[model samples]
Target chain A: MAKRPLILVTNDDGITAPGIRTLISIMNTIGDVVVVAPDSPQSAMGHAITINAILHVEKVTIDDGPQTEYSCSGTPADCVKLGVREILDRKPDLCVSGINHGSNSSVNVIYSGTMSAALEAGIESIPAIGFSLLDYNWNANFEHCKSFVKTIAENVIKNGLPKDVVLNVNIPNITKNEIKGIKVCRQARANWEEKFDKRTNPMGRDYFWLTGEFVNMDKGEDTDEYALANHYISVVPVQFDLTAHHAIQQLNTWEFNS
Target chain B: MAKRPLILVTNDDGITAPGIRTLISIMNTIGDVVVVAPDSPQSAMGHAITINAILHVEKVTIDDGPQTEYSCSGTPADCVKLGVREILDRKPDLCVSGINHGSNSSVNVIYSGTMSAALEAGIESIPAIGFSLLDYNWNANFEHCKSFVKTIAENVIKNGLPKDVVLNVNIPNITKNEIKGIKVCRQARANWEEKFDKRTNPMGRDYFWLTGEFVNMDKGEDTDEYALANHYISVVPVQFDLTAHHAIQQLNTWEFNS
Candidate 1:
């Protein structure tokens, strides 16, 4: 029999979140799992890393499982860096993040700690994937998406991801039977229209709560937003090479010397 | 007389950092400046937005400048969000983040709070640019790049940026006379080879301080890394779309079932 793949599992929702626990259990059925995740919730951390502070990592067993787990006092991106460098004996065959509590579709990917972990792994030349459920509830049902998750992971392991690329998979908050298979899509053109809720504390200083409404401006059927809206598991092949190649030519045309 | 443009200035390196002070002075030469930046150093914050905590914004007078300034207890991205949504009376004509104390070239762009502020503005359909110097010191001399910075900002204001794109500009830590002209380049293919400095804490627990050496793997002359190494100011057009469009067709061929 072939040796099982070594899977480095992580998430932005912290080590104890149900999202990662479900991801761990599923990976166990397919590979040797080692989880190095954040010690506390790091939602929407983007690709932030702890550069100014020291990081504390401790081994913990949240539940009875075969997977080895270590929680780090850092962001999701820091967890991946530590996992790949300090914790793991060798490079992982696959690094999977999330099973995130909410969607990382379209513009949300830029703000996602879940996707950032996966992107960090990809930058290290590791084939990685970040998974997110459309549901935001802590007790959201993940049972319906297990088979689909397993299938996607299996496929990724069998056929390695392209260089500089990682997968951003967002599942609709629908039953397993309702999922219309998977769709390979691009990120939609979207943004959050920020609305700050200003209030004064007892100290008489005004503070603002970050609040926003996500607005999808793209009507493209080939976008992840379209796929998820149609009850399909959207798989957007995400890249960290943020260079806008097409814009480069146009930028070159402008004379810098006045 | 044409109304002077309104330019929103911000940075990852706290409100009083010399980088932003230099940036403010340059913008003041070209437009009406409003400075909304973090109260403390927020380097390497990536695209993080303060969602879990309440943000405090206070009016500050860092120096005897004509610019209106506000310091916020949030990440660089949060400063831009708050600036546009809550602080500014109207959408500014342009947004500029950083004359950063360090380089955000190559893959470093993903880990940069300076660039994140610019990207956040781009998402809001505002023309934006992130400027970084090759030096890392708090008092790094930004004087040498003043003319270049002015030229670039003026060019950006004259020729509005493409929709959904921002500029990542890096200047070499060399004298003005030695500096080559600006070059529009792609993001280099490179990443940090992370080395976590493991140390035993006073409490007898192991802790780590993240350290890394940047490894440039790209040989392309059109890359930002190449431009900077050759003493040229590098400008890479960056987009937040994140989609790997080239990989989509290949991913579509994968079997999602069985």
Candidate 2:
């Protein structure tokens, strides 16, 4: 008999969110499952880790499943660190994060707690992926996501991802029959056109709320935005090595010594 | 005489840290400066923005300086957003973040608040640069850094940075004469090997403190780690585009319709 691969599951929407619950159920059928996730919602936390504070991890049973779960008091990146360093007996065969409630496509990848967990795992040389749905509702239909999610995970387990890379998989908000398939794409050049809502509190002090509209500036058909818009599940291979290597030569041309 | 260029100065070590104070003094000599930075230390905050809470910015005078300052109650990225949207009268010609008290070389850039501020600016289409000193002390020597810092800033002002790119500059901890000049380099592949210091609290609950030893796995001579080790200030052009473009073709070959 072949040994069952160990799979570590986690998410940004807390341990008990529907997104992670759906993810845990899918992972259980494929391999030995262990979940170490944030105890509270950590959306948009980026790659933050708790350095100045003490971290706590508590064991708990959320539902009847073969998976073992631990609730962590930290960010998504911290959860991966603790899971790998403190909880897991050995290195897992695969690490999967999310089924996130909202989209992590395009520029949102830079601000996503879900993607941060996958990146943290990738940094540790673990095969990893981060999944998200276009819908932001708590009860967003994940029934249609099961087959696609399992296929992607199984493929990753069968074939290792590229070095220093992880997958950002975003499913469009649609019926199962509507999803054409998965398409590998690039991150679009985009940003939030920020608009601060200014208001006064009862104490007579001004406060502001950070709000924005996502503006996609790239018109290329080979982008994640284009893939998602065309009803295909977008799979953008993401890397943590941020160096713009091509720009180094141009920068070297600048004089630094006075 | 050409009008003095407007410069936005910020840091992750709080508004009153010696790092920002030194940065402000240098900017004052180069241009008209406006400082918008965190009210408290926001080290290792990554690219987090304050979305679930109200943000506050208070104007103040920290010392007898030519630059105007504001203390923001938010992360480094949040400060950049607020500075651009609500605080500044117009778009500044240049945005500079940090004389950060520690190195932001190699993979540390993924977890750095200082670099996040610079990235935020780059996304806004403003030429941005993040500066760091290898010394982590509150009072690291800036006397030797003044000339080099000024030269870099002047060159950036003269020639704009590439699209979707920002400069990450790390100065080595050495005397002025010992410095070997500057080098344009790529980010080295390095990561921290985390160790959790487990302890029992007053309630007898287990808690952990995140600690680690940095491990540099890449031996490339053109990397920022190598340049800094050789006593040269390393400048790596960093881009916020997270896509692993080279891996996209390989991923496209995956069978997803199973």
Candidate 3:
């Protein structure tokens, strides 16, 4: 019999979240699963690593399955680091992150712990994917996202991703039937209109809770936002080489005598 | 007279790093400078924020400069967020980060706290730039970096970067004379060949210090890595939009139902 593909699983929503539970079930059917994810939630932790603090890892059994699990006290990226280096016997055939609680669409990819895990894996030359849903709840309808996740994982197993690139797959918050097929798109030109909620602390010191309005300025129909709005799963093949090559020539025109 | 540009300054090498100090010095020449950077080094912190902690900003004075500085307990992204919504009086004319201790060239852009701080400003509709010196030390050469920083800041003040796009400026680790003119280049296709240095703690626990060899696979002459290699200041106009637009059609072809 052919060797089962070794799959490394992770998520930003923590090891206990239903999202990872569902994600694990799908991977069970695909390959030998090994999960190394954060012990608690690491939402919005964009590419953060635990350098300042001491890291702790515990052998965990979140569920009784064929897969082995280890809970890590670190960011999503840290989980991947542990999964690849310490836990797994070999480099994983694929590293999958999320079924994230919310969208990692457009500009969110930069601030997303979910996608960052995948990006970190991609940096290791591993074929990685981050799967997020449009929904933002703990008990989200991850059941609907299962089939799509398996399909993408299977496709990756068949045909490899581009070098130094990873798939950022975001599924709309809808039933599988209502969901339009996946659409590969570019990062949308969008931003968060800042609105900080300020309040006085018990000591009368001012503190602000970060909140905002997401404003999409890009009118281009060929964007992740556009694809998600049309009920399509957005698969942006994100590259780690963030060089804007097109702008290089324009920048060369500037004369810097100093 | 046109109001002194409200310049928000930040860095990944901590608020006390010579890089941010040099940045603040240059900003004082052009605008009403407000510094809100991490209190400690946050290198390789990408776009991480302080959602879990109640972020605090304290007034700090390190040098005799026109700029008002505030040290923050947050990442580079948090500094930008706190700068606009928590500290600064108004939206900045230009937000500049670093004179970073090390290079944020090539694929390092994706994993850069310096660029993320700038990207945060750009997300807030402010013109932003992230500057870095190829030297990585507590006392990297900032003397030669001054004029180039001033010139770039001046040009940014004169002609704004494209909407939603910020500039990532990387200077070679060389003297002013050895430095070639600045070249606007795309992010190079390159990555760090990561080697985690594992060590046993005093408590007999194992820990790893993330270290790496930067391997530039991109041979493009117009790449940021190439520009920096040739002793040229590399400036890549970076965008916050993380979408991969071209892949939508290709993803749509996949049969998720299958």
Compared with the true structure, what per-residue lDDT tens digits does model 1 show for residues A102-171? Answer: 9999999999999999999999999999999999999989998899899999999999998899999999
DockQ of each two-chain model:
0.90, 0.89, 0.54
Q: Model 3: runs farther than 4 Å from truth?
A: A52-54, B202-204
Q: Sort the predicted structures by lDDT, highest score first.
A: 1, 2, 3
lDDT, each prediction? 0.94, 0.93, 0.84
Query: iRMS for all predictions?
Result: 0.8, 0.7, 2.4
Give the B-chain TM-score of model 3: 0.95
lDDT of 2: 0.93
* Of candidates 3 and 1, the better by lDDT: 1
- Tens digits of per-residue lDDT for model 1 on B1-258? 188999999999999999999999999999999999999999988899999899999999989989999999999999999999999999998999999999999999999999999999999999999999999999799999899999998898889998789999999999999997999999999999999999997889899999999999999999999999999999999999999999998987799953
Task: Give the per-residue lDDT of model 3 (tens digit) for A1-258.
Answer: 278999999999999999889999999999999999999999988887765565677788988899999888888988887778777889899999988999989888989999999998988888999999888888788888888899999988777776667899899998888987877788887877767677889999866677778998888787889989999888888876655545556656666653
Model 2 bad stretches (over 4 Å) = none
As a whole number from 0 to 100, the lDDT of residue A27 in candidate 1 is 98
Clash pairs (backbone) in predicted model 1: none
